[model samples]
Target: MHNSHIFDKTVLREYDIRGVINQTLNQNDAYVLGQLLGLIVLDKHGTKVCVGFDGRESSPFLCEKLSDGFTSVGIDVINIGCVPTPLLYFSSFFFNADAGVVVTGSHNPSKYNGFKISLNNKPFFGEDIKNLGIISKNYSYVKKSGNKIYKNISNEYIQRILKDFNGNKKLRVVWDPANGSGGKIISDLVKFLPGEHYVINSDIDGTFPNHHPDPTKNENLKQIIIEIQEKKADFGFAFDGDGDRLVVVDSNGNALLGDQLLLILAESVLEDHPGGTIIADVKSSQILFDKIQILGGIPIMYKTGHSNIKKKIHETGAVLAGEMSGHVFFADKYYGFDDAIYAATRFLSIFSSKTQNLTEIISRLPKVFNTPEIRFFCNDSEKFEVISNIRSRLISSEYKVNDIDGLRVTTPSGWWLLRASNTEPALVARCEADTLEHLNQMVSILSYELSLNNIKLPISF
Candidate 1:
């Protein structure tokens, strides 16, 4: 029975089950996941589920099969139609559903698609997702039957944001949805907001003809920055393939890294909840930690992945949390799921009472030189081993090291990080310091350490 299906054990990843369509994942795979997840949800939460999908080419077919599988197992499926991942997360709480699933490829290539799941308002990830494979193989059941309800959740989601923020200040904001699922919602959202909005690539196109929907890469954001400059806008925002992550640009068209944006949002959130816990992934700069401390908020550095950070945030009851990859989660005034559109709205709200622009606020922060993420490819089997070897070497060294996610060594001038990429067969490294010279020195040390471990340095900048 298993061999007859297209589900590959390799495709069922740690965080979300993703793979190349037709080859590794097909209608049967989606149906199996739907059946397994539905049964799992019923066993754990005893309630219905909310299902949504992004503008991926494969999403519609997967959603249909998954819905069929859910109904086959006597589970109620609230189909929210095509929406961003965050909108589905919003429906989970807004409708009081048991769980939710977002069919999205995220920032991956167009050929891939996957599921990001939430159960009982918490992330269903890591081993939870992996164990679904076992459940699918072992569980014995006949397809009983259930029901699927179609609902339009956009208006309610829009109203929630509008109600939370009521600002009369007018500003010029440029939005680039990159033709993802967020494209459908951004127009309506900007319509209600007080802004002179210039939207580019806001039409839902799964092919993403203009550019890949990932905003993390500078190339993907070029058009948005150009539009921002051409229009002389106040600021700009870009959403990822699924619209869970956000990238921002200043009025001058300077791309704001996620760490910098996190600092800006953290300050605003900490105003209402003094000394509240704020979580940032280990990939964030040490400057962010120092600033958070200076702001009178507790800054805790945790593991990278969105699922890991969200779980830690729940455990610590943090008011806000974010990753350097632009996944910003707010527990202060909204659901904790990372929502680019929601974050963009909240960021604009920060300018309501101030004449200071985003660039000005960013300039006020202490400047620190940092390296963009550098990735070096490694075999999947060798990736963890390389990190483990590096960790062991750092343990006996004079440099202070943090092994939270992988290894972060602190020097007098700055810090350097080397971690295994969760989604790919690559080792991710970054360095930062008070000076460019110091940053270069840290990078050199990292290079020496990796060499000692016999790992080849592929690219250096």
Candidate 2:
């Protein structure tokens, strides 16, 4: 039997192991990963692990190989079958496992499949990921067969998610799971929720026949928008492939941005935990942070990745935290992990308590014009360099900049962000302003900066 193997360097990402199946990731890679993770868990005095997979074509085969490898190392495995990423995270706490791994590609396309891991409920990332590479190159293990037990905790998960649903409104709601892992959970959840529910694409289809599972792009949310408008529902909710991120559509079929949703949720949280610290990624609108201050809550800007934000929330004891990508973490009355299903319940509870509709509530907030996150191809090798150059230039010119993750520069009119995507070989950019004219100017500034680096801003802008 082989004792060592090297992984594709590209798959060892900062946050998780991920790559296109068959091409960059294969069963052997999964087996090796299982072995490496098993060794790590054993070292930490942990005897059991929770394993789960999403509704991806390659997920089952990969999961089996992973389990085989884990068992070969005498590590007991608690298999949770196919489920959303949040459920996998939840399994860690429910089973009291020392470690956990989920076979999922998250918001990536259907052809891609990989893993997200947690150790003792903490996200295993950054240097922890790098250490996997070093261990895989040379490691020794005694092969003693362990046990694998299958567990179906979906009902318990559903019950826990509904436990926080305090909404008494019988409002009509539309749910679109995009045929991903969250479909079954949402299908089961609506039965208990006190609302007129219409669910679309709840069938588990690995092919994702309807559309791409990502909700961040408005294009993917088209179906939900139409359903909400045609059905005249109070609102709608959409989920990404792994169901951790959320996209909400109002009664007018308008999809709310991640920051907007954060602002809405913060309003309720701040009331309960007065003078509490609420965290948001740097990409969030300035208006969100300003409003937090107005609500008598402390607002902190942090790095963009979910792992980064989650860790920050834990370290600071913050009541709530979120990313512009729709990953919201709540420490109040729930685990401090992003669970879109739970978030949906909380949102409904808050909305039911109010008399005004979603659109009206949104209208009352300060207005700001901003571009959706724009991503352009940039080689992984050079993406960081490009951001560094821009950061240096901005600082030399005495521009107010936040470099927590990348460069978020503030100007007289508004602010702009240029950051390298941690999960893809692309540079992500966004800009915001109080007026259309100022928004255009901010975009122009962003474009000019990219031009200096021999990169063209996406022409669609």
The whole-model lDDT of each prediction reads 0.86, 0.91
Clashing pairs in 2: none
**Over the stretch 193-268, how does candidate 1's per-residue lDDT look in tens digits?**
8869988998888888999988999899889988988998989999897888999998787888889999999999
Please tell me which predicted candidate would have the highest lDDT against the true structure: 2
Worst 10 residues of 1 by lDDT: 1-10
Off by over 4 Å in 2: none
Report RMSD for candidate 2: 1.5
| Residue 231 lDDT (model 1) | 92
**TM-score, one value per model:** 0.97, 0.97
Model 2: residue 271 alpha-carbon error in angstroms: 1.1
For model 1 the local lDDT of residue 312 reads 89
TM-score of 2: 0.97
Candidate 1 segments exceeding 4 Å error: 1-6
